[model samples]
Target: MSRRVLIKTLPLHSNYGGILQAYALQRVVRDLGCLPVTDTSKPLPLQRRLRRRLWDVRRGIRMSLPARFDWRWRSAREATASQRAFIARHITGGSFVERAYTRRGRALLARRFRTFVVGSDQVWRASYADLPAQFLDVVDDLDGDRPRRMSFAASFGVDDIAEYRDGDRARVAELIRKFDAVSVREAAGVRICRDEFGVHAEQHVDPTMLLPADHYRQLAARAGVAPAPATGRLLVYRLDANDHLERTERELAERLGVPSLELLPTGGPSPSYREYAQNRSAYDLPSIEQWLACFASADFVATDSFHGCVFSILFNRPFVVYANASRGASRFDTLLGIFGLEHHLTSASSTAVDERVFAPDWASVNRVLDAERSRALAYLTANL
Candidate 1:
């Protein structure tokens, strides 16, 4: 019999990084014959004061426009530029997105599944306005029966946890110890869990990369992305740099006058809303593969996000990771170091301006990926 595992995530607001990770996990879990169930939290009617706070988080903290209505409902309005760029490069046409959360909705999810597995992304991050803490407790949900629980490669970045207190950490330790297994994507996460939660975490690839880079190539081919460009001078967004990164690239484009394209991840301001539901998260917007053709045709890469860095490595494309001094240097730094490709990396201040592809070890990266995949599979199988 298949184990019914409800996959939980922070409210999906249209993030390719998060969507790709979740989709890849669901896909692999299914391939492994593990039930990959979708269970979105139901939205609740916010009091006037509470609504304002949530809106601030959705827009202020993370720069996302929280829809006035439910976020679980998928819609077709165009996305912001960063989201569009993400769509053009990694995800395909929008499908399987969500836009609303309600108490009734949460009830449906609880009724639909038994066990729950959370994260391959920042679902645990405080970035989300209504965290899954709504669904979790120091030991269990404050009132509801607990689902069988585990966290697969989840992260809160390099930040410390503020929610656990009043012996809550110990209570969470109870929850952590109850898990059949746990895994994390970054070394920092490994350290954090061990140091704070008393759970020795195992390292695992983001589920998206577990499938192999060639799989993405095949996906592109299947989706009709013709071929890699012939002249080959693709400037991927590896820099953790911000608008300045764009400005620098613009200058480079002017000087080189060669064909170039940029893959921007979703983040930033939202359109004016007629109401709360007027805007939606990028993850709720569309799939990156819809525009994967753009990246498939790229000659090289640059990016700041961890998965952005991973995809570049997966494609064996020479890429530079812009150290974002803004976000306390992404966890990307730690993961890249783990792979021994540390030399290919540079921080935002590095003089490595618009660096080109250097010799990289695809064989070595894949070897590491394979082992990580096995470790992840082992955790899942043993738990089931």
Candidate 2:
């Protein structure tokens, strides 16, 4: 069988977690002695693209208003330059193929790559415009034996899929059942696969956790990211903004006696709605290496992002998780549960910060991480 493998996951964009997970997976695969190429060829459907453009246009009109206009606000492309550059250098570049769903495309893919991996993110989520492509449906035309199909840490993103159309749910179930092996990132995902898709899936840590913190520090060094100067700063990385999360951040900062440093704006209701309010430099994404350095150097961390929590734990940084119910709270529940730090999960309404988060038992946490890392590596080695 050809050692070349193709990876299918959500398209690479500015989401730090999404990009890192793709890079981590490809790195792991290459270390296991296989050539991995992520498939970035899939494009969003015409309708989805149109809807996004319309939303952008409306936002542009609003930002253009005299009261809201800021001369320093940067364009989206300019803001995301560092992120896209990292993707080109480490994740995907000229490897992005044209449409691979046609008959000829499938034959070429089968001939070129022997394995297809479809996960480590919310690729199974029903609302994605390109749901079939994420499920590796492009290979359906080829004989099953030619290309092996599997998913590592695939996630549905939400516990419930009913919000999406029934046809999409049924089709996803059908496609999931055909995979040769399956693993999920969250505990709830295991249940969802068994109950909803009638397929049993083992649970594994997110691909990011499979690598140690030293690996990221080295990567940051190689990228010319300066070593973080010692500081008493509370790093706050949240995906969504609400009064509760704001309160939590304030309270945590008070308890830690450190000033808070927010890297991303968790806009009101939407992640990007308040983008114009910040200066142009605020909009520029920190290089992935710098992002890692933040987690590594923080005295205390409070975030609503799943990857934020993951990095905090990986770096052994004392931290708290403000539950992000929208993105999927189950991800937090399962992750914290594994290391017996469930008390660290807080909500918008929680009255007090957990004293436990101020001082985690790093010795115990590291032991659990080691075990989980070994389990995840074994799964990849055995399956791949």
Candidate 3:
């Protein structure tokens, strides 16, 4: 029997959370004694390619602005160098099959791999181009010999399917019904899978939480470059900027009496992460290791990022999440609810920063994490 497992996920890119989740899933699969490969090959539609080229022309104009205003500019390749390096070193086995593959080509893939695993991100979300591919429709196209299909922590990125077009919802519903097993990252996803898709799904923690803090700390240590030690510092990571962020940061810093280290070259937590890549100079962009290190070393953390909240809990750093409604607040709700830390979520308009926000019960949180980690790993072992 072929032990090769093809993981269908959002293409690995500069987003720290997305990349780390991809890495963590592959790592978990390797430990489970299967050869895991992620679909890192991104195939953009021609229309998108053309649109991107047009954006590139506008970005060039922006890049040409005076150093006083556009000082952070660096080629995208240069900015993403460290992130690419980490992926190359730790994450491997890229599958490049596109939608245009021949029947024979897909048949060959069917024989070569026996299991297709999808998830640990918003793989089910409608905004991404390859929704059917994420659902393992490529494997279904193989006809007589189809591999087992399973979703591990897949997400819809929204609470309901009302936002999705009728055609997309019906198509997604049809594709998802064929899965051997389904699991999602958020509780709302379970409801969606049941009510919308008419398929049962278990809710699991994100793959990043499957590994121990020591695993990430070792990754940061070996990566050779890190932001300066954030020990005793407040780490502020925000994907979306709002009028209230500055005041929130100021208040947190003042209350904590610590300097703040903000993750930068910032523009995302976007579904496509293209905004971050397009808008920032490479020099201003932080490496994946640097991003992980901030969580590892920080005394207190504040952010509107879901993964930021995940890492703070993973590393047991005292943190507050400034709920990012645009990026799916349900993700934060589900994740924080799992650990009984729902109080950690705050907003720009939220005036009072509770004393408890600065102090999560690490002992209790770790207990929950340990139990949840066991459940997650067991799901992989049983299903795969």
Candidate 4:
């Protein structure tokens, strides 16, 4: 029988990078000769769900006030609908454990899987750190037959552990010590694991980097993404859209002489919940597969998203990165440094788009990527 692994991370929702990373992580696990399953269970209780709805309704009413009315909220809701449709169509190979938070649910999960893997995103951030389920605490407590616990490319989502509250830091440290093996996505994460927790953690590339570019190309094709433009097109994917980024993209498009396209439904945790709730639009949001196709089809890509930068490199497209300081800049810095493309990094304040032109030495970058891949694979094989 194949060993079964239950991989848990952020829920699959509107976030493109989060969903794609979850998919990529499963693919990598399966490549290692194990069955990887995502926990798609909606663990929130009915009361919590009701309370959430009431909160959203209340917020929506407030936002609808004549003085506060904004149209972006409508766009957000429409984008969310499109995102859900995309996930339903493209995401597969997963099993759901209903009511996974209950005693029976917990027992069912323990009975069904032998290994639990947590990570590939900011699962270790302070917001989720206190949650026992995120830490696989129930699995750890399984009597005499606990499954192996490991983390792959888990990130703290910040440059320092000090960013977490004192109580949260201590709790996170305690939970992390229970893992059989731990690998983080950033050098800063490694430092935190060592300096704060006294646990040494190896840094690995994001799971999205484990697969080849062609793999994503095929996914795009499956999603029915149209062929790339005959000449070349400038693709802009900015997670945090601002006037500065907008100005930069327009300038780049003018210089390159290619039609530019912007991926919509773009916003992050920084936006108010009420704003996102009220946003509704008919603009079709691309599925994760379609999103990959966007990158694959691009002649040049520009963005402030870490995955945007990663996909640009994976597709070998010339690209520029605007630092997303709010989301965490270390992720971009660390990944870019690995490929020796730190020169591509720029700030929103800078007007020039590094006009010298991008010509990455793929041969050297791939060599470094290969070594990192081996390290990541070794960690999984040894721990699992």
Ranking the candidates on TM-score from highest down gives 2, 3, 4, 1
Give per-residue lDDT, candidate 4, residue 297.
Answer: 80
Q: Score candidate 4 by lDDT.
A: 0.76
Q: How accurate locally, in lDDT, is each candidate?
A: 0.57, 0.80, 0.80, 0.76
Residues 102-174, model 2: lDDT tens digits: 4565567767777888778777776653766677766776744756889999887777666557776787788
Clashes of each: 43, 0, 1, 8
Please, what are the lDDT tens digits per residue for candidate 4 over residues 13-67?
A: 7788888898889888888998888775434566886887798898788667653
Q: Which model is ahead, 1 or 4, in terms of lDDT?
A: 4
Residue 212's lDDT in candidate 2: 87
In candidate 2, which residue pairs clash? none
Name every residue pair that clashes in candidate 3: 79-282
| Model 3 TM-score on a 0 to 1 scale | 0.86
Stretches > 4 Å off in candidate 1:
42-76, 80-111, 129-135, 138-146, 162-174, 229-231, 238-258, 265-287, 325-330, 353-357
lDDT (tens digit, per residue) of candidate 3 on 181-288: 898999999999888889999999999999999888888888775644788888888777776776778888998798887777543322123444455542446778
